[model samples]
Target: MSKENKHITVFEHESLRTDRGEQRLTNGQLEALQLFYGENGVPYYSLIHHGVRFNEYVGVIQVGKTVIEVLPKADKSNDADRWRNVLINMLHAVGIFDIHAPSNSNLRLRSNSILDLYFELFIKEVEYLLHRGLVKKYRKTEGNRTALKGSIQFAKHISQNLVHQERFYVRHTTYDKEHDIHAILYKALKLLSYINTNVQLNSRLGALLLDFPELYDIKITEALFDKIALDRKTEPYRNALEIAKLILLNYHPDVNRGTNNVLALMFDMNVLWEQFVYVSLRRHKANATSIAAQNTKNFWKPLSGYRSKMKPDIVLNKDTEDCVVLDTKWKNLNGYNPSPEDLRQMFVYMKYYGAKKVALVYPGSENRNQSGQYYDHSSQDSKHLSNEECSVISIGVEKDVKAWQKIIHENISNWCQLQEIV
Candidate 1:
């Protein structure tokens, strides 16, 4: 590992090393990674003998000053830049980050890693909010005032201020910027200032910190965010607050060792791929009457205990009849057949959902859709095979997100014997 190279890009299930078999992580970085993957944390990666090996989770993880960007690789191409672009496009398609940034080209050109892109987006949002002026809200503040204003705490006033009769201890309402939204933004900005490695963004971050007012730090929690009610006045801060929640939630500082301050913004590739495909298909519904994602059905139940449910990734319907059930797998088939487990799962889904057909979807370099029929095991005559069909669909990944999505829609529509509505 070299201090000069702060940013490194690797794909899922890859070792933390370069092509030449050189170690990319120093001892401290490796230690930090171990601690992050330790107990009580999401197991994003495994601790290899040499270093950490990223699993199916893809995104950016920053330990100390080093940023490790793990990207998804379904195709055979090992081009880091292409995969990076695909990941960003997938994220945008899935609505993780809005694509309304001022200059996507500039951010893509200047950003070295996904972390840099996130930092740039946060900074841009905060800058926009500042230019528009921060919003204020009414908050309850309790203090000792010389003049009586709000409701006074008689108990506290008598006990604490017995000698000072002029002073009034009261809880008053004041409209100010000391709210949860500002506190979240301030915390995110402060965290960015510390973990950000991009040299160009430092000055902008510095300017933001200088201009942004410092409010009282409060405990950050998901419940706090859930309680936030955004009206017309606070609507402008939505994007900034979204980014702040992302940063503040993912950041885990090493309180004991004070060395490995981990900021992991990772996404499960399986979940992301499923979502990307579902959204792409949903976008171009073609001739299908309706499309549902993760539709569940009660599959099994015990005599007394709770029953188990089975969820199919995507279910396509033609009018009132179940047409197709699709299970999306984020892997490159590479001329290999679908696993027995996958085939069995699809068969079960088709039977449970009463779908006329089912398919196992995947991502690959080129389109490879293979159709097969299941045999009737209970048939006495060998010639009497069931008419149930299942197809293995590998939707090709293109450079452009729209193009890939179009391919998916077309292939699925054609396979399901549905004409494009357009």
Candidate 2:
């Protein structure tokens, strides 16, 4: 079967759809759809024009050739009342739901929409912590501490008496009226305030200061110092200082610390795979109408001397006759611009595959002509095509989990334009 032979379709409420039609589905799109359906308990199906076999399950769909799985409605709730619960869970699972919500209704509705109930639950837990005192209280009599040593002795006596006295007698005689609920309330408020402030600081770094007061204060001081150092650098530091800002400005420290801990605990391969599929599908939706792939053994024979056997990410079939060869890189491409070597590798891929356009997509960047287009260079080596023969493009992955779908779609659109695939 040729690359153009596989097709998969999903109806809004249908169990699944698979047909070996002329239309081809991009790997990314297929993966995203599968994930969406699988998560929703919808049946998933796929058919390849070639004789490839696939494994299927109740909420999982896999493409035989690519081993791509889709989970539909992973976070969507069939129950209206349970919408918030399901949405919040989904948001957390995808790491896209924001923590800030002004009201319970807002939180509940947004959580349901995003399928992130855990986040809402975390928020509720924080609210509970804020209202409740951290320490337990006990009562003492008015003359309980009259004499220093005698009071101690008397207190001990009372303690024992309390343990053995009948329940009603102990309640009437031993309860202390002078106990300060106001003071306890004040202390609880302070603790809650500190937690709210610090959880925001910790989210970006993926770690939090211990609840010990002295330790937390010390850590905050040290972080401020590091931020100053980072500010002096010529280039912006995306990982450390910026992330610190994100946590401090966006997350509640005490609440977010617990949230991060929970997220770390729940991280798994299935989650990661779903994320990958989501990103890929989003890109495809943004870029091309349809995409297909062809595996060619000894495909690099044309450029054997210059490059090794390499599997192209996808062979895109656009409206134009010129094919687009795409390669997806799961790395940060923004830090360094593509080097001459990078350009050369892409050029080789294009020439070998007979693709007029080529794209090298990094995980989270967009394809833009930051540097001007490469001009074809005439080399004495007859096998090498001039630079003008192929166009190499770079794209970034979407950082916002919520915007993954949109970002991917936009990127794919831009990528197709760059390659003139559309």
Candidate 3:
């Protein structure tokens, strides 16, 4: 499908495409996207249409595509493993429903559509939820080979046929599938089937689904889940449910029903990167150190009683005295220098928050990709911080987990000025 035409796609950050040439966000759409970003605090996209510019950074944005259809930007192909893994890991790190999807065969390679990828991963989660404990209830059945399972349905009893002179009874029965976990699983699976039935599936996921016995056959929707109350017994379904609800709700041609109604299943790279950075850093918090995401909800009192918010992205403190404030930007600092607005924001954070140093952490450029180690780059300037200095830290995103952990650890240790632990 042409990008300018209608389609539901999973897009990566700074990745919007256009083939129709000159394009820009319509005034109404521009206001709407920005307003949503402001409320959510996730810098969604950068629009540069016909010399008009807005948002944190600048990029080409197409017109004509409906807000719900274009959905958002598109840079990276969804076919690669990096794209999906990043989304899953970031969601996991941020604690948005803890899910560790076991590495499977070519889930990334086989699936290309947004709907396809979501359902493929989502089915695994549902399979996990149900497999953790197969949702079982006393389902009514009537057969000549087995005993009566539930109360008999005398009205439609078929006792005419006998199997091998029958050692068991035959009767009609009506029983409860319970609308419990089993019903949810059944409905969720049915929803998965509807997501994209025509799309081709990789051998791995197709085989994986067959592992679980079809638990139930029932109709369900987003509302079906809402009415059911879950307790500690069925708590395992929580994480999987959060993901399923989104996929089922927005994984359609019409994301929402009518008039400029755009229900996005997309995430802002800036938001995800910031969350991942903070989550990764917090893993190494020392006994004598403290780290706060978004700075303890602390605001600066610029004019006594007239509170001004000084919400930096991250704050690290050693023994509660010398603190280093850090903020994350999704843009590649290697190609693009830090903007004056970014510098001013950090400067204000350092001056008002009493930070020793403020590091503007950003994703390093793909050109600097290294093997077996993360490429680290920084530009230190003495003018930024009040009496100290600021570090514009950029680290490679393509590194393996252990390498990234080590790289970030070293950066934090040096940035905080804490003595390295042996």
Candidate 4:
């Protein structure tokens, strides 16, 4: 397939119409998407009657030869290419991609999709690892050998080696490059070789596969990645291993058809926005202030079973007390009123966390700051307002990520300082 024909770009909440030319997906591709949605709970897209409507998640999804790049769009005027760059910058800010600097020349390439960037980065990591020499670890092995090495299994040795007296069944530990980490990298490389459509990355990927050791395939799972422990010697492989884990875990191969494997490399924009805000604040926070992400507090308890907890996206603490609680929303307000549920939730967070100020943070075209106060039930006068304040702060997105982050930190710091005045 030609690159132009195979690549499709759509924004969040947009539909992939089946009748649209150059944007319609094949039946095989739809089937692959259906399977992926069915298996992955909290799907990124919903199946329409004749199309697929993507939600607030953005990233690349590759089905067979077709690559669908979903970009985040909070503004009506933003295009796919612009939001694509924003998404890439956001990912880099959150440390998802380890690139030192992404140039305009790189982002301007129409031929490169997010998947291509991912493949190229993975290939580079593997190339560096091969240059430094693959790390070897001691792994336990059990098999039949001609010469006796470690302690022999008596039952297996007696049964299997009865006919062949020279053969021995023994369990031994061998120090070699054939370990779980290498196994994972090898698996990711093999997957890339099969699904990658980039012509430029193919030769480099081929060289990586040749240099990378062929290890036995193991079942890829969350637990497998959790079990990995890196020391000083293997620390350099951290970036490569992180990417490998992402690729191996997200890939779902078709068992019945074998051709329409689905690889969904996606991120929830809401979550990403929250993280980006938290990272920005943490990086530029005052010496006395500390920032935490996803702080949970006990909200409700049933007579039996697990208790419910309220987890706010970001919390800022000055010295010891909670200074401000900020909940990040990815949607553009556009002068619309905040949702009632969101206001009530922030109120609960304020009362429970003892935060003097609470804010709902959003992304918008221009910087907006709105402030309000909660009604005090204890006051005899119904019109009396409490000292606790709730504000809506929107930080505008800038062309440069550093400038955008600076705006975020500045706005948030100002919000925190306001609490000190009262």
On lDDT, the leading prediction is 1
Between candidates 2 and 3, the lDDT winner: 3
Please give the clash total of every predicted structure, in order: 0, 52, 3, 0
State TM-scores per candidate: 0.92, 0.30, 0.58, 0.89
Clashing pairs in 1: none
Q: In angstroms, give how far residue 135 of model 3 lies from its true place.
A: 4.6
**Model 2 clashes, total count:** 52
lDDT per residue as tens, model 3, 346-420: 766766777766778877643232111112223355334233456677766542554565566666666556653
Query: Cα RMSD for candidate 1?
Result: 2.7
- lDDT minimum window of 10 residues, candidate 1: 99-108
Per-residue alpha-carbon lDDT of model 1 for 1-422, expressed as tens digits?
35834777788988883223544777777777777777774658887686777889999998877788898998778898898888888988998877333563235335667788788888988887888788989999887999999999999988889899989999999998888889889988998998887889899999999999987787999999999999999987887788889889988887767766889988898899899989998888755367889998899899999999999998887324646899999988788889999999999988788888899999988887899888886787767657888899998888899998889888887777755422
| Model 2 alpha-carbon drift over 4 Å, by segment | 1-289, 293-296, 300-308, 318-320, 339-341, 363-367, 371-378, 381-402, 418-422
TM-score comparison, 1 vs 2, better candidate: 1
Instruction: Rank candidates by TM-score, best first.
Output: 1, 4, 3, 2
Tens digits of per-residue lDDT, candidate 2, 1-422, equal 43422323221132332334433445443444444334443222333333223222212122222112222222223343232232233445455443332355234323211112332334333333333322323454333332332133445456655664432222122432122322322332233333332233224212211231221112233444354432232122222223233333322222322211100011122334335434455344424445654334353345346543565556665334566666554434445666677677667766676775776554433444332345535655566544543333444333354465555546555655643322
Overall local distance difference test of candidate 1: 0.83
As for lDDT, the candidate ahead, 1 or 4, is 1
Q: Which order, best to worst by lDDT?
A: 1, 4, 3, 2
lDDT to native, each model: 0.83, 0.38, 0.52, 0.82
Tens digit per residue, CA lDDT, model 4, 61-84: 888778899988877864766788
